[model samples]
Target: MSEHVLPQTELEAWGTDVQVVVCETCDWRFVLPAETSLPRCPHCFGTELELLSGEVSELPYVAPPEQAVPFAVSEAQLTGGIETFAKGIPLPPKDLNPAALRARLQAIYLPRWWVDAEVAALWQAEVGFDYEVVSHQERYSDTVGGWQARKVHEGRVRWEPRAGRLRRTYENVMAPALEAEKALRAQFGDYDVTRARPYHVDMVRRAPVRLPDRVPAVAWADAEMALRRRAGDECRQAAKGDHIREYRWQPAYPKRNWTLLLLPAYTTYYLDDEQRPQPVLIHGQTGRVIGMRKASLKRAQRIALILGLMALIIFVLSSISLLAVAVAPPLLVLGGIGLLVGMVLGLSALAPLIVVWRFNRPRRRPQER
Candidate 1:
């Protein structure tokens, strides 16, 4: 929308602590106020619009992201991934193919926050130590000693005082900005956050950057809990004799480093035949793709029916073989027919699976009738 076209009153400015910009043209909003040098709106398709609400508001309620996993997966790899994912579902629609659907792939940076803190405390715990001891056993010797007893020896633990400090740069522990985080992970698998880098907006040039919605206080609390979990795990690993079950500590002089990080992803929306927006998510860094793809249930059912009919044929042939066995005692011919029919039914299963795989593949090309 042109600046001359937008309404005068600004809608409420919403989003995180960083820069904020409102589109005077369309109602669409964006983080990071528009640069004076840049003529068009970056977020809303570059509509020539005036900034209705250029007011900067403190994003105290949101946690800025710290770092991110750089893009490792390429477009080809993502396409292949999408193709593989489409193959597993049952009875899909016909219009869900890579060629038939419109897919737009743009990289997006998701928001996350990191916290660092220190803990100091007076703690008390008994650490375990293992020792071996022998006990005399008296037992009956096979034939010579009629009444003898046996003693057994065993190893046991001794309590000891243990103390330690834990520290680490916890990387890639994630928070989801996307509404479909679960479904995305289900499709692309898990991310290893150890490789994350500090957040930089320019790195994510093409797609939108999501800002955290969590307030600093709440995010800090969450980070503390996460840090404690990590510390507990370290304690258990360091235990020599047995696992560490419980812990008590007082944290002191806690200093925190807060960061805003971005995760990469590609998002595209397609208008199905019904004109509904069907969105797809791709792992921007790894190009691992996952989305809803369509397949023809009718086609699959037809193939399945053929296979089922072959199964029926196999059963019939087997029955005939049994009958022939009763009459002629030589039923090898009927048995061979049964085997052939069984093979045909087995071959019938491939069609549906193939149909599904094709359905999930990202449409590099548009679908045709």
Candidate 2:
């Protein structure tokens, strides 16, 4: 790997007295200020965040980001997204409302490996070019009242072996720096990287930048693969082919530089019925919200209790009415109706519990990477 130096001023902004902290539960690490007391991990909301005393140099890349996609989500968009998320839950916890979430929201930046490399490669692939074939078929047509010749067109590809030598510089190639990157994108969706602006010191000073957990040694392979795939596409385009396959490359990188590219996101959490924090992530660009909308068991149980009490009251009134039938014979019909209504009310007490149980039940589903 090629070495790159970070500016002295920017390095100070990252904090000279900074310490590395790793969440014991999620194993996600972040570089934070030395005096900053973090009660919870921003990524997973884990309470056990261990502060590492290792030197910054021990980590793979400590240099500040070269570019960043600034948070574009408006205040209105953020509130609207939270409202939509909350509405989906049947009985959300008290702290899960939009007002509470907005107040606790913290702006943070997630890391991605952005590498610039000069590549020289001997590449081979099968390039395919599209062509059209036309044939005439004899068909009986009701409109013509006689046999007619119809033309049929079919599209096909002709594959040919192609080999070439490429020497090019690819910059800002993206690769996952965190293990949870795939799962994060699957939930929050993609960012518009093209809109990234040059990074400034103020960006890090205001919000925490999650450091890359996957070192350059691991991410380099992914970066090289992306470069090779890009080269293959360009080669096919140069050959005037429609498709390419089985691309293989033997490459040498004369010079390469690895830097972090930060993407904007907001992290905030709401307490569930059990008082455990449930983390919520919002896309900084589009205000897309992704998190567990767990129904509150406490709230559900409260409703059930109220229903049970009402049923008991109805039964007591029915018994009194039934006793009154001795004094007036016409009161017998009212007593029967009261008993029936009490039974229905008693049965309805279980509705909230069943709804909450089904909503919060653990279902078999694909676990996000």
Candidate 3:
């Protein structure tokens, strides 16, 4: 891997008392206090690691982010999201209610790296321009008993071979800062990154900030791909073509700049049957919730028990009615009614039992990304 250095200005912000560690297994970087013991990488749970011993200049600390999209979701919005999530659960755990979930809300900022690159490359592609062709079709209508000419417009593309040299600079092309960045983006959906404001310490004071784990060297390939895509888009626009295909380029990035960008989110957890924490993530900008929708087996069982008791009571009454029928003919009518009612109640009991079974059915757990 090519070595990349952090700007001198960013290094001055770090205190000498802080220790930076990198996991050898996953290449995850973490910043800790000097006295703290090293912990496994949270993403991959990698144990094998090495600690760095050098001046700040020798370390590969990414510069702190300059701008961030602050949390736009209000407390009311978050509550609404939780309530919506809890609405249809058959038998939700007591701890999974809106109030309980709201109490555990935690703010977090996830990191993404933005890269700027100046590139000089020779590129070639088949550019396609769109055109419309008009054709006439002859059709016979049974009602009219006549042939009619129908005109139809069909869209077509004209392709031409083109070759050119591209010398341009692409600014703030995005790259992942974490291994699961793509999954996170898919979960949260897109946000207006342009709305980000200059980063302020107070904005993230109470929230936990996730530092970048994917270094620039590892992320450079993604950056280059993004740049090439941008170049292809620009090329199509320049050629006055609707599409480009079979595009290839040999490019050299003469200059590159890397900076961190933080995105806001809320993270919390609810315990599952095994008392293991199951995470629920809500988008800070959109209030979108993503997590497992779990049903409580204990709650389902309680409901099933109540229904079973109701069915048993009806069955016992029917048995008593059968004995009463021996006394008189009129009593026989009562016995028959009791039998019918008991059968209905017994059938009704299955509804709750089915609910219990459905709620307790095994399901795939939600994955964290």
Candidate 4:
């Protein structure tokens, strides 16, 4: 593993009064206001949380964030989004509704590492320039009744070897700050980091900020990869080539600056049929919602009971009609129809339960890290 030690200049004490709390279940650490009372882990709904006390420097990444993306979605939009999400669920749980989810919604800022570095490297590559070649071919045409010459232009590239030393500064190359960032991105997709505004203490004074678990040492590898990609693109531009191949570089970082860029998100939970919390995450900007949609087995059972009772009533009426057939022969047809209808209704009574069972069937989902 590559290790990038933080310089003394990069370490700073926490600016806002906050405490670090970690979820025992998910191992997610968050920085929240000291007075905030958290009943459960926002990410996993785990109730086992431990409050940690330590100096800022003892934390893996101590510097405060420089920028953050604010919640662009309004309350009405959030409510509508949740409503739309609930609409897709079949026999939704009683607690899983727009009002409940919106009530429990908590603002959270996810962490991403923003790195600025001055890189110096020796690079080599084969640069290719586009060229056109003209050629003539013979073609036969029925109208001409003779072989005619056809001209063709073919595009090709001319390769040349080139090498040079590169000294450049790259800024704000973002990398994941949390181990679960991949899962989060898979859930919420990517954010437009360029739209981020300068962060302020008030922006996250009440909201919890998820702290970085993938510290600079582990994140530096991803940063280095991003830097190399930037370096290659610059080299290709410098060579003024349409294509480049076998690009290789040896880079050294003389100066590095590390900072944080927080992205906005919201988390809420609702109880399923089993009374377990099912977390719902919403994108702060786009208002996209993602969560496990569960059907209410209790509701399904109640519907089945009602249907079964109706079927039983129909069967009793059919039995009375059959007995009346002893006196009136015309009642025989009515009694048979009633019996058939009653049987059909009884079979249909199981439909709701079957649908609910299918809807609530367990499936694999990405585990929160």
Tell me which of candidates 2 and 4 scores higher on TM-score: 2
lDDT of 2 by residue, 232-307 (tens): 9999998889999998889999998876788999888889888888888888898988888778889989998998
TM-score of 4: 0.80
Off by over 4 Å in 1: 1-66, 88-91, 100-102, 125-189, 198-201, 237-241, 269-275, 291-369
Q: TM-scores of the models, in the given order?
A: 0.53, 0.85, 0.81, 0.80
Candidate 3 structure lDDT: 0.72
The ten-residue window of minimal lDDT in model 2 covers 1-10
Query: Which of candidates 1 and 3 is the stronger one according to TM-score?
Result: 3
- Candidate 3 lDDT over 43-109, as tens digits, reads 3333533465455445444455667888899888888888887667776767777777777676777
Candidate 4, residues 237-289: lDDT per residue as tens digits?
99999888889999999988877788898889899878888989988888888
> On TM-score, who's better, 3 or 4?
3
- After superposition, which runs of candidate 2 have C-alpha atoms over 4 Å from their true positions? 1-16, 48-50, 53-60, 136-150, 316-327, 357-369
Clashing pairs in 3: none
Which candidate's lDDT is highest? 4
lDDT of 1 by residue, 1-369 (tens): 111222222212222223444446534333443443323343233343343354334433232344677877765776776565444445545444454422545555655554545555444355666777888877677787486766677988777666665544554334444344444466666665667876554553344455444544455555666666666656655775464445665555345555555667665544444544455666666666555555555667677777778787787877778677767776867677787777777677677867756664767642321
